[model samples]
Target: MENINIKQSDGAASLAKVYAIANQKGGVGKTTTALTLGEALTREGKKVLVIDLDPHANASVHMSYFPETVTTSAHDLFFDDADFKSLWGKIVKKREWVGFDFVPASIRLSELEVDLKDRKNKGMVLSNSLDEVKEYYDYILIDCPPHVGVLLVNAIVAADIVLIPIQTDFLALYGIRLLFDTIKILNKVLPSPVKFRALPTMYDGRAGACRKILNLIRRKLGDKVFSTVIHMDTKFREACASGRIIFDVDPKTRGAQEYMQLAREIVRNENA
Candidate 1:
């Protein structure tokens, strides 16, 4: 991958391409996309780090780190005053099987909205924290919660690109507008507007409604919509349940193939 051209707060160039996988709608494959794409990027020999910002900790559980069991997690980044260099080893857990590192989430993150409500520059907290260690990886993917809150704002502010996974359904379409509006408001104060792409997920070709919605997304969004469409697959659920990536469970499956293609597209796009 080519250099991302983003700079840290200290004026040093950042090595990682930070991607926030976000959507205010639930069951839209936000966590799935984050994990699967992290796995796919590793297949291409990229160093990847996935940060679970969701209080629900679905990604943490899938990666075999429970919210209650993890010694330290992403939650600490928000509340702890220690330098990230000292906390990095403790917060970032490596999964050898998946070939990536991740910052797990805990239930404590659920209370951050209330805890940080009065804090100054709260949205920049994650961004500032990530600047301390972004050079260690080639890509950093954040799995954001399915809601409009301080957590989601922090993720978007910290990201170079916000990858919105949109399920191919009517109600899912409404989520795009909500998130876009949020991004618009954020851009007013951001140094630069956050870049974003819409990814169609859970598509079933047999369902006419799914096909129509996919078409509508592309028609309305144009090139903002990714060329790769993630088809509905039971293997993804199985892999999550088994704590394995799709490539490990069955690389031959369509779900695995699509994510690999998506990774290649990202690599090529960055290189371009």
Candidate 2:
């Protein structure tokens, strides 16, 4: 497999490609996509780091770290005035998901929205924090929360791409427009070369409604919709319950296969 050519500037290290998995709708499989896709990328020999920005920390739990037990979390990195690198090193946790690492989230992150209310340049905190360590990985995936808040803004400001995971349901479709509107407003401010795409998740081909929604999304979004769709599978929930990724629970499952295909598409598109 060919690796992506990292572009450096002025002798500074090339930063990792940051992809923020976000959707204003809940139960859209954001955490699942972030974790599974990161693992798939790791399987391809690329260094990947998944940052759980959601206070729920479902990705952290999937990585075998309970939210309550995590000491130094992404929350600490944002609020604490300690050494950035030291805090980062301490917060980042190594996972058995092929060689990928992740910075777990704590419930305390839920308080950030109100905590940073009047702070100057609060939107750029996540971006500034990531700049220090982005060179260490080839890709960084951020699992954002299900609502529009300071955390989501920080993730968007820091990301090079926004990967929206929308479930193949009518309710999930309702929030797509709102999410894009938010991104549009954010783009005006940050002005970074951030790309956006929609990925259909929790897809069940047998369900007529699922097929219709998928087709509708493709027709409306065109090339912005990923060709690979994450099919609905019970193994996904089982893996979460077992505190493991789909590949670890059953590599041959449709869930694993779809995520691997999604990872390949991401690599092909980004590296092209």
Candidate 3:
């Protein structure tokens, strides 16, 4: 399987953390962050595996080939297996974006919850699968489903850390609290604990609601919030549509630079 491996020097994998880029609210740049941040990590020469866990397949859409596609997706990994060896082989090397491999999301994933929700040890499925082939990469990022469902639970159950992208608005803070409550529930259910940090996304500093929401998030979540706030940038979505990451599209753009800084911040904090 030809995969995207970083050629530069990104510090060796310190924690072996599986970070799930998650959000219950749509349009908060969850998939955008996953795609671009993975690219940024690759730029620094770190291996990254992105698992598109959503049935909507938004992450796959952003990162993978759209029209002419293959079938090795979340559904195939979890439900299908005539032979597990070929599963990892399906990971295509993204020539356009360096340093990342993707487990694409299938349309059949929409049927997963209704199909496998009641199965035995349901939450462990994706985690167990990753454990089987985790040595192929350093960082694993699961792009979770938009709601609190079986898919979300499975991702949360497996994550070492979670990066939540929250919009800067009034109701956004309330929704994020609900997401944290979900995390607490999953923490109690899983044997190993998971850590989390919230990032303010789609921010407009001129808006009072943006300031209010940030204050509320800081007051409630405190230091768990990421120091970098991602301001509104249309180029990011345009980059996705153009079949590339923000940094690849325009490295000098504020949004692209902020995401790069976010990656460095996370890497720096691992030792602290």
Candidate 4:
């Protein structure tokens, strides 16, 4: 894989570092990491925009925007040829509570595979679309779907970094090889291979199995594994139920603190 290079457009260089939070396996805390990291980045005084590409719309709902009510969403970027000005004005919604911009996901996104099946450059659609507004933010977080398909490809193609949240358990490593293989295949075609980091989530220090899995992850991936580990926290569920981020629910909690550390790590790495 090539050294990390942020995607640059034709005009002035884009300030945004796009991150795709993805994992082929479900229940791996992809949405949680996306939303929390977004909020955490905002707390660090960075402008963040989260693009919800998951058809389940978990990130959208947690941010208090329901897909059913929105007329335009991330789905429109895939199908419509609307100008950046129109799309930005219509699709991006500001969240006052978390202080980040968001593009909600629509249930209609589930149909995009068939809808754009015949299109030649379906994967490049998102990369092209994001370039229009990339200069406006410091970070753009894309919440990808669980399964691999057109939407996942679009997200990967558009991202500078792909964050994979791995649940620390006996089955933690299961099916992850498939995702690695997919990236390898993409690297054959991309100008630069997508950079990725594995974040261990839902960890319980009391559980020997969790510790063993986390150790195995670090042993297997070395520097690719993030130092920050998201411990199992019930507050995450409460925050989701209340339609707020962990920081709003309780900033002092481990869940909130760890995500903040993650944001700092990312920023520090960029500077390095």
Query: Cα lDDT of all candidates, in order?
Result: 0.89, 0.85, 0.76, 0.87
After aligning candidate 1 to the native by TM-score, how far in Å is the CA of 167 from where it should be? 0.5
Where is model 1 more than 4 Å wrong at Cα? 1-14
RMSD of each: 4.8, 4.6, 3.1, 5.6
The weakest ten consecutive residues by lDDT in model 3 span: 1-10
The TM-score of predicted model 4 comes to 0.93
lDDT string for model 3 (1-272, tens) is 34434332345444346898888888788888888788877776667877788877777776654423744566777774455555556643455555677777777777777888678988787777666556556678888887887888888877878889998887676667678889888778777777888989988899898888888888888998999889998888778778777776789998989888888888778648
Report the C-alpha lDDT of model 4 over 1-272, residue by residue, as the tens digit.
11112323346454699999988888989999999999899899887889899999999888877877878789999877667556666788876677678889999999999999999998999999888788878899999998889999999999999999999976657647778888998999999988999999999999999999999999999999999999999999999999999988899999999999999999998889
On the 0 to 100 scale, the lDDT of residue 111 in model 3 is 78
Over 1-272, each residue of candidate 2 has an lDDT whose tens digit, in order, gives 11123223344456789999999998999998998999999887777888899998888877777887777788986786557766676777775444677888899999998899999999999998888778778899999998888999999889988999989999998788888888888878875655889999999999999999999999999999999999899999999898888899999999999989998998899779
- Give the TM-score comparing model 2 with the true structure, all chains together: 0.92
Task: Tell me the spans in candidate 2 whose CA falls farther than 4 Å from its real position.
Answer: 1-13
Over 4 Å off in model 4, which ranges?
Answer: 1-14
lDDT of 1 by residue, 39-151 (tens): 89999988788999999999999988887778788999997756766676678887668877788999999999899989999999999888877877789999998888999
* Native-to-model Cα distance after best TM-score fit, residue 121 in candidate 2, in Å: 0.8
Rate residue 91 of model 2 by lDDT.
78
**Candidate order (lDDT):** 1, 4, 2, 3
TM-score of each: 0.93, 0.92, 0.89, 0.93
Model 3 has an lDDT value of 0.76
